[model samples]
Target: MTGALTVRVLSGLTELSLTPPLARAIWGEDDGPEDPVLLQVLQRVGGLVAGALDPQGQVWAYLVGLPTARADTQHSHRLGVHPDVRRQGLGEQLKRFQQTWCLERDVTRVTWTFDPLLLANAHLNIHRLGAVAVAYLPNYYGAMAGINAGVPSDRFEVVWPLGGAHTHAPWPMGPAVDPLRDDLPADLPGALALCVPRDYYRLLREDPALALEWRQRSAPLFSRLFQAGHTLVDVDLSRGQYLFRRTAC
Candidate 1:
C-alpha cells in the first residue's frame, strides 16, 4: 500500500488499510469483511485484484478478480463498495473501471451474481446501468451468514455482455403496455421466476409476505416461458426489476 489515492496494482501482497468492517458497512454485515488476512490469502490463491485509494494514501475501495473461473463466460470477481460511501455511485464507478480493465486485457465478458430479491441492487445493476439477470440460482449461498442471514440467499446470476451488444431474439419489447394483461401467465409446473435485486430485497424487508407471494405466483409463468423455449438473457435492469428480454424462442 503506497500513498493516498493511487490505484496501484500490487505485485505480491499489499495492505491498503481497508478492512472487512468497511465492506460490511456498505453491503451489510453478512457479505464477509474486507480483511487483509483474508484478502492476502485470496490474492495469493489467484485473481486480478486492486485496492482503492484516497488523496492521503488510505484505502477506500477494494476490487477483486474471480480469476479462476468467471461467473459466466467472462467477468471476474464480485465488486463491493465500501460500506461508508455506498450509494454515491462508487459501486457503478468501480464496475465500469473493472469492465474497462477486463476489455483491455482481452476478456470480452464479465458476469456476477446478486440476490434478485434486493430491489436497490436490482435497480443499480439493471436500471442505472445495463446488466442482465438471466440465471436464477435458488438458495445460491446455502445460508448467508451476515446481515441478510435471516432470508433465503437465492441469487440471480447477472451477466454483462461486454463482448458486444447481445443479439436478442424478437421477443415483444416492453413497457409491456400491460404486463398483467398482455403477458398472460404461461403454464410452468416447476419453474423459478425472476426477481429484481433491489425490489426483492425490499420485499424481504418491507413485506416478507409479498415476497413469499411472488415466489409462488411467478413460478408458473417463468417456468412456462422457459418450457415454451423462451430464453431470459441479460435481464433489463433498465427500469427497476430484473426484466428479462426473451432472446430466443
Candidate 2:
C-alpha cells in the first residue's frame, strides 16, 4: 500500500531543488534535470512546476509545464516519478493536480509527447488521461541517452482537454498491422490496430537490431495513417496495440 501524498505547486529554490535529484533518479544519469533558471522562469511566467511528496517528506514525483502560443493551452514538458514509488498511482495523482491547476488558470488543454512504442506510457497518456494523438513525429528529437539511447526518437503528440467532459471513442474492431512483417497495408481501414512490442525496453536490450527495425517499419505506417485522417484515440495495453480511427478531414 502507498502512503499519503501531498501534491503541491512548487516554487522558490528549496522546493524546486528537490526535482533535479528526483529526475536523475527516474531518468538515469544522461537524462538530467530541468535547468533551475528555466524552472524559476516558468513559475514567474504562468507556467507550472509541481511536486508530489510522500509521507516521509521526500519529493517522489515532479511535473513541469509551459505556456503555449495559444493562451488556452499549455505544453507539459516533463513528468517523472521516482522508481521507488512508481505503479502506486502517483503519476496519475500528479496529472490530476495539473488538471485542477490548469482549469483554475483558464487553460483548457494540455499537450505532450511520448514514444509510441512504450506500452506503459501509451496506456497512461491515451487510456488514463483521455488525450488524443493528433500527429506522428518521426525522429522528433534526433538523438537521446539512457533508456532511449540508440533508438530513433519517434513520438505521438497528444493533447489532453481539460475543464469539461471528455471521452475517447470506443475501441474499434478493424484491421491489424503486423509489426514483424515487412509489408504495409495497401489502403487505410475505417479503424486500425497497430500492435507494438509488449515490452520495448526488453527488446531494445536483448535485440537492438529488432528494436530499430520496429521503429523503421512503423514510422511510415503511422505517418500514413495520420495523413489519411486517422487519430490515435485509445490503446489496448494488454494486447500492446494502439487504436486509431479514420475521421473526416
Candidate 3:
C-alpha cells in the first residue's frame, strides 16, 4: 500500500474539491461535509491539509487540521480513509505527513478527539502514534451521524507531543482480558488499565440500550480518572484495554 501511494499537501480549491467526496466515502452519505470555505481559509493560514493519492490519481485518504489557539499547537479536525483502501497503513502515512508538515512550521503538539469505544482507533492513536488522552468529553458533539449515529458522541481528547521521549518508547504489552466481564482494579497502579467493548458498533446495532448503558457506565469513570491526573498512555488491542498512567505535574 505504501509503495503505490503518494502523500502530498493540498491547497486552495484542491482541498475543497477533494475533501467532501473523500469524507463521504469514508463516513457514508450521511456524513456531514466540511465547509470548503473553512478548509481554504485554514490552508491559506498555514494549517495542514493533506491527502493520499493512489497511482491512478485518486485520493484514498485525507487529513484536515488547523492551528489551535496556542501558537505552537495544531488541532487535527478530521481524518478519513476511503472504505475500499482501509487497513492499508494509509491513515498512518497521512498522520506522519501531518506531523512533518506541522514540525516544519515549529508546531510542537497536535491534538485530536476520537470515540473511546472504537478499539482500532484506540490502538492506532494511543499505541502506535504515542498520543496521550488528558480529557474525556461526554456527548462531545451532542449527537453525530454515520458511524457515530446511534451512540453518544463521547470522546477522548488526545495530545501528541512532538519530539517527546514517550514517542520513542516501544509499544506496551498487557495480559489479555475480556473487557465486558473483567473486574476493574480498585487501586490505581503506577499504570492502570480499562476496557471498551470489543465491537461497540455491533453492540449498538444489536442492542442499542446496552450500548448506551456502556456509555453511562464509562463516562463517569473516565471523567473521574482524567480529573485525577491520570493520562491514557497506551491501548492493548489483544485485551481491549486502554492503559492510563499517573503523570507527575
Candidate 4:
C-alpha cells in the first residue's frame, strides 16, 4: 500500500490465477473465484479482465466484464477490492479503468447488479458514478455464501451508460416513505424517497433478525413502486433514502 497504484489489463494463466486468492481475501473464504480458464477464454473473445496492482505488484483490486447479447453493452460481473485497502477510492478507480476500456471497444453501456441495502455501494453507483438503478430483482441469486450468507439475494439491476453521464437529476427530492412503517403513500406529484438502512452490514451483525425483517418488509414495497413506473434516480445517503421518480410517459 505504499507506492502509487497502477491499473492494468490482466491476461494469461499466471496473472489470472492471482484473482482467486484475492477474491477470497476481499469477500471471505466462501467466495469462489471465476475460473482462470474461462477468463482466458473471455480475453480471447474480446472480454475484459483487469486489476489494480500496488507497489509490490499484488492485485489489490480486480474487475471482470463480459460481452452481452448486445454488442454495444457489457455486463460487469465482478469487482472486488482488498479489505485493508478499501475506502481509498479503489473501487471507483477500477470503474474508471473499466469506463475507458469499454469506450475503446465501442461499448456504450455497462450493466451490473448490487445489493440494494448497501448504502456505500448505492452512493458510489448512483451518486458518484451516475448509474441508473432500473429494476428490483428479489432473491435474484437465491441463497448465497460469503458476506452475503443468510440473506435473500435481492439485487438492483443498474445500467451505466458509457456514452455520457446518466439520466436523472443528480440530487432529486420529494415526499418520503419510511419502509419500517406499514403505511405507504398512494400519490405523490414529485420524486419519492424510500428509506434504507444506513449501516446494513452492522445491522446484520448486531441485530440479524431486524436485518432480515427490514429486507422482507422492504422488498415488496420496492417491487410495487418499480411496477408503478418509478425509476430510481439518486440516493440521499446523508438522509439514508433512495430517490425515485415516475418514468416520463
Best by TM-score: 4
Q: Write the per-residue lDDT of candidate 4 for residues 1-249, one digit (tens) a residue.
A: 788788989868888999999999977799878999999999899889999987787888999999999999999999999988888998998898999999998998899999989998988898888888899999999988777777799999999987764555745444468778854577754577788999887898888899998889899888987888887778877889888878889
Clash number for candidate 1 = 33
Q: Which model, 1 or 3, shows the larger TM-score? A: 3
Best by lDDT: 4
TM-score, ranked from best to worst: 4, 2, 3, 1
- How does model 4 score by TM-score? 0.94
lDDT of 1 by residue, 1-249 (tens): 244344544334345335455566655766765556656666665445665666654556767766546433454455665655555676666666777776776766667777644666666665555666666666677776755555656666666666555343232333432222334444422222244333565566687666665554555444445445444443444443334444443
TM-scores of the candidates in the order shown: 0.68, 0.93, 0.88, 0.94
Per-residue lDDT value at 62 in model 1: 63
- Badly placed stretches (over 4 Å) of model 2 are 1-3
Candidate 4 colliding pairs: none
Q: What's the CA error at residue 110 for candidate 2, in Å?
A: 0.6
Off by over 4 Å in 3: 1-3, 167-187
What TM-score does candidate 3 reach?
0.88
Which regions of candidate 4 fall more than 4 Å away from where they truly are? 166-175, 188-190
Local distance difference test, each candidate: 0.55, 0.85, 0.80, 0.86
lDDT of 2 at 148: 82
Alpha-carbon deviation at 13 in model 4, angstroms: 1.6
lDDT of 4 at 61: 90
Please give the lDDT score at residue 248 for candidate 3.
89
